[model samples]
Target chain A: MALRFALMIDPLAADQTAPDLATTFTAVDPAAPALTVGELSTQRGDGIFESIGVVGGHPQEVEAHLERLVHSARLCDLPEPNVAQWRAAVAIAASECGEGEGVVKLILSRGVEHGPTPTAWATAATAADFSLARTEGIRVVTLDRGYAIDAPARAPWLLLGAKTLSYAVNMAALREAHRRDADDAVFLSSDGFVLEAPTASLILQRGDTFITPAPNGAILHGTTQLSLFEHLAARGFETAYETIPVDELRRADAAWLVSSVRLAAPIRQLDGADLTVDAEFTASLNDYLLSPRD
Target chain B: MALRFALMIDPLAADQTAPDLATTFTAVDPAAPALTVGELSTQRGDGIFESIGVVGGHPQEVEAHLERLVHSARLCDLPEPNVAQWRAAVAIAASECGEGEGVVKLILSRGVEHGPTPTAWATAATAADFSLARTEGIRVVTLDRGYAIDAPARAPWLLLGAKTLSYAVNMAALREAHRRDADDAVFLSSDGFVLEAPTASLILQRGDTFITPAPNGAILHGTTQLSLFEHLAARGFETAYETIPVDELRRADAAWLVSSVRLAAPIRQLDGADLTVDAEFTASLNDYLLSPRD
Candidate 1:
């Protein structure tokens, strides 16, 4: 079976030179595209973004994605992009999507023209490949130091949950994890609460309850995880938004990383600790994901 | 004399669509002068920017600006750009700069790319009119909501003192101040500390005691401020990096906004409250500004 992807990744064995991804993608058309870039970044560092998997010539759950995009933007105190324009742009980009499944990303920034104004926003889509997920569930690491979101004032400015452009720290944390010979990283709040894995959703099962961090101002409200909740609910699993303690998760029935690309990847081993319930939950979740979303 | 500017307002009325300031300036390159829209933006907003003003039309202080750029990039945790390439790009841009007391601005940004990764940054330069500073001192409003730099882990993430692309908040604050019928805005930290004015350097008072927020972590270290400090030392004024409360500033013997563009603008008011600082400091600072360094 051939894989479908939004991004085309040339295999390490392929001969052709990788395209200058940066320069080639910019539009020559000035007026609208100009507005798009600025508006997309309107929230300064208080916006949300999604990099999703487009499979079998269809961007799965696009409606759900757009819905979350709008919700995330509003929560971040940003003016919404015209939904029609957004849908059209995504559809136009999706139509030209090449062979195989790839990745499509959406960003909603503070739309502040001068970087501090906070007025406009822009959203653009790009297709890329991530077949790497199919072969290996990422080797994840944990940060010894954690983020502090202890105050209400801190809550408003703690842009981590909003997925804003102020992503340097988060990316830095991931890089630190990578440097430690880990594929990805999970952040713990300074008080030792398990926060999140960089750029993906979290779901841990303890008996019948599927638990993750509450999508309050402290955590990014992930669309993929919300969708998975529906399946968990129908299957008689109690879904929850309460904070799951690190100790509890390590002892949970099963744990999985849910994201658009690797729909449900089992947490094979976390920080060298083997998770016992990986296989059963991994198979069940994959079966549900392979079924049509109608 | 008729002023040459990219967007100068008519003093007589709101004639925003006046004839071109220069008949020779064109949208194209070479004999006809050209400027990118992004270049025009550096002058707008209380936009935090570094300019080692032009000398004989050649951009001086490239190293200083580059050093500050890297520092700003680090403060904002932005991906490092190729400094050598940037230097070469600015040199090429500087060569295109025509003479007559103008400044060359090196504006670094996330460029037009969207998503998790940023596209390459670009720099452009254009001639600026310095005559505006030779005449008028600016009017400014002081805002009391000061900057956030108290958090131990997060305070280091404050981009206050660096000239970064995320300047929309400053621009918006200026607009808010303008809407309140003020020319510009001065930022006051939450603790009543008198930080730097929106675009310019801090206002220090008396001969031996000048006050501005310590560049410890909260403010962009101003190149012009550094120059002023050097001259202040030579003139027997002891420049100290101590935090001055807003109440002390309101009662200061004198105050002025120092910057590359305004050079030295005497602060006539703090918010709507009046200031009694004499205009002589503006002249002395101006002298220090135009005087060639050894």
Candidate 2:
């Protein structure tokens, strides 16, 4: 699927007297240019973003995504985003988009040089069919993230927790995975612990219980993983966030790379080591992820 | 100082049958937008850039900057930039820019998703006056870059040497320096070696000799510093690149952070420790840096 819809959100339109936020969430032609060349989003990647998975015209976990957006803004030292304003924009984008699986992205840039206000916008795109991976599973290779898990707390300037637009390293890791003939990658900390994947969270399972790398300052607190854990706990299964060692990955009975759009992809192989796959369980998790949660 | 000129360069226009590269670069309104929300440059900070210093209507070190741009593109797995087309665009930008001191920024983004061509542009802005820092000098602080020196060699995917647009961490480092009451920050390798500043290169002076962190696959080979070394060597000053230890910074007779637009700023203070400033020597070096150099 291609892009289903796009909207240019006016983050500073609250003071306007226009009803229905008529000026706040305006429609934008998705194909046209909508950003200045000077935007720090492009110049310095000085921004934060959020991508909410939308299914059947229902945007999932709007509150959680918005909360994470604010969390990211705080970590990046950006001005706090107005959650109410953004929630409204996501609604408009979801309703306008095709009623199939999709994603809604919100961006808050530091705006143009010397400009008074920050640049804000939201765009919606229909997600590509992830049917094959969701069922067939994906092979993953472990790459070194080169940072000790403790690096984040020692140097907040690294912006480790913030989901800023500085994703070149992440993108590079993905390319390396493809070059290695793997479908995805899992990053390992320099101190010999398992970190998250480039764009998703890493979870290892044994029997019925599941364990994911704890949300240390170095790893992103994955939204999808959090929701999945809740779902798992409700189903009477044990779930946990633990500091997983490199050798522990080999000991796992099963594993997965989970995210909002891709839902859950069972890790069939890890650095040449094989893991068991529960096709029925993985399918049920995908079903839970694709439904509107909030 | 304000933005003086902007040009959108078509990197794929070689097939056009036009003269003066007229169809290649078109002047853009500095105040208007020129990018789409879907562009990877803004979405993922997926691009490379070069900033050339312009003095008295001459773009200094154009070749070096462009060469570095190509180097960065290759490191980031981006398409090799068309240097000839970029040089022409830079010339046009410099000619239209104001005299005195300024900067011309060149950006080559991965472009909009699913688009055939890459998005490229150049913009000129009059530089902010650095009279105080150039003469009076600046205070410095050291921050951890969180990567071991050997890590870069081990993991090319980290893109340590690439001048990528994913600069959120650099921006955060600068902000951290400000909060610490310092004028700038130098990144220290996790293994106790000096790296470089957020946007400038670090050079330590002792007696009449100077040393900068070697371009050892972990640091950007600073273009301005390279030019200054050539100039200094001509003046009978010994210049070398070495793996300087952290303690070596405190033992230096003097030090400076050098870059294109900022030229050279002597270090007056480092982490609250004082250092001597050589006004006459610094000014002459700036004079050399300001002149058109290829």
Candidate 3:
């Protein structure tokens, strides 16, 4: 299949192509068809993706997201995406968001069968409101991720480190959480150690210090959590990365699931057991998360 | 996004819409843009699919594939497909393949974000040549599937048995096998039990009895393996399904990775060690596989 996105950028009226490639991405209609029937993105889910939270038309943590995108590309053996082209695409996507909290998804597929180029695109959509989730916090259920903590190291092919488009398991875990009457889920490794949420990273407050599971190949290294840790460090609260046991979670004074779009949402209850939700502390964290980052 | 496939089947002209949905599916151009960028299939890999082997214009194991399709939908919570429509689509897909072996892939995606209906279609393509693999047999390596055999039953949301399109790990395992200088890979459960292949089923011939892993919700129920077992039983060979351990494979007199498209390819070697490859027996199995079946 020919690159439909490439055709959208090539020889045609500047109006048809939308002015200039330097200033604009291929103008796309959300209601129009964009990918071929054989694109691997849809066919095999052989692709990598990132969802950047855009606030007030300003994309957050672009560098970190782009770095992780490159890392995911390496892990998946997908061709490294051209950072300049993607940055431009992300700009185009951010412009489409207009204002307020939005999410811009950057996707890089292995492309159609035997096609010359990878299918790359950015889509911007309005973010779902997580005001209640951020304030009142969220109820979470812990589910087994079905892999040992060291599995990713032993079996790199499992792709535990990559942020791939093959997120059916992640989506299913959320559904399972809802079935258990909780709003979200935190995944545990098969050998009974804490991991992260399907779409987010986990950070727990133990007395005074904050701790998250170490980035040991079994989990996607959390960009938001890193930035939050930096912010916490600046505020004189100790932060660390550790191998968290399942029991350590219960001992946590407070917990939060941190992500790009929803920011920091405190865990009000985990498995029907109440956790200390410091409303004031969580608001401070959210406020910091909402702040402009370069 | 609008249903582009539906648009292909809708009115402007009968030539445009094709003959009839009852007899013919919407005539599709394989290279054309058929899916929107927002589709959950591409976005989250949230979909179910089946690839049926078609030989001499006859689709093999139609009822079994359709039954599995329904089983997958139930596990994934997707809308139960209209069987009659899918059967007609399959016939149309099968017709697209002329005189040789071909593959018709049926995909039912969760559709575009907020779309009213699921996006469904079938695409017909020429099968890859597996002559060398089928005749000389293939070298196989074992990789950990990262889940215990009982994990599927314990966690229904893991979608262990469902034939979903989130096959990144499956694709990755094959890459790992190739890197290790092997042609294919067999998945072993983390708790030391034989699972299936990334895209095929495993059958071991221990002495006179042919055995496959039991369908205990851990591995997929292979349609091709089941057909082959039935054929073997008819030939007066004993056939059984049992919980095969990883050790039992090495002790087996012979083994084969069976699937649609590729059919039956015997295991010539396991992790560089030679296994007994019975050329005449494998050829007979392929002959049965290639025979016209409703």
Give candidate 1 misplaced runs (Cα > 4 Å): A1-50, A71-80, A106-136, A139-163, A187-198, A243-257, A262-277, A286-294, B1-60, B70-88, B95-103, B107-122, B125-207, B217-219, B243-278, B290-294
**In model 3, which regions exceed 4 Å deviation?**
A1-24, B1-25
**Candidate 2 stretches greater than 4 Å from native:** A15-19, B15-20
In the range A111-220, model 3's lDDT, one tens digit per residue, is 77776357777788888889999999999999999999999988999999999999989989999999899999999998989999999999999978999999999999
**Model 3 fnat?**
0.73
Docking quality (DockQ) of candidate 1: 0.08
- Candidates' TM-scores? 0.66, 0.97, 0.93
lDDT computed for candidate 3: 0.85
Error of 2 at B282 (Å): 0.7
Instruction: Specify the highest-lDDT model's number.
Output: 2
The DockQ score of candidate 3 comes to 0.49
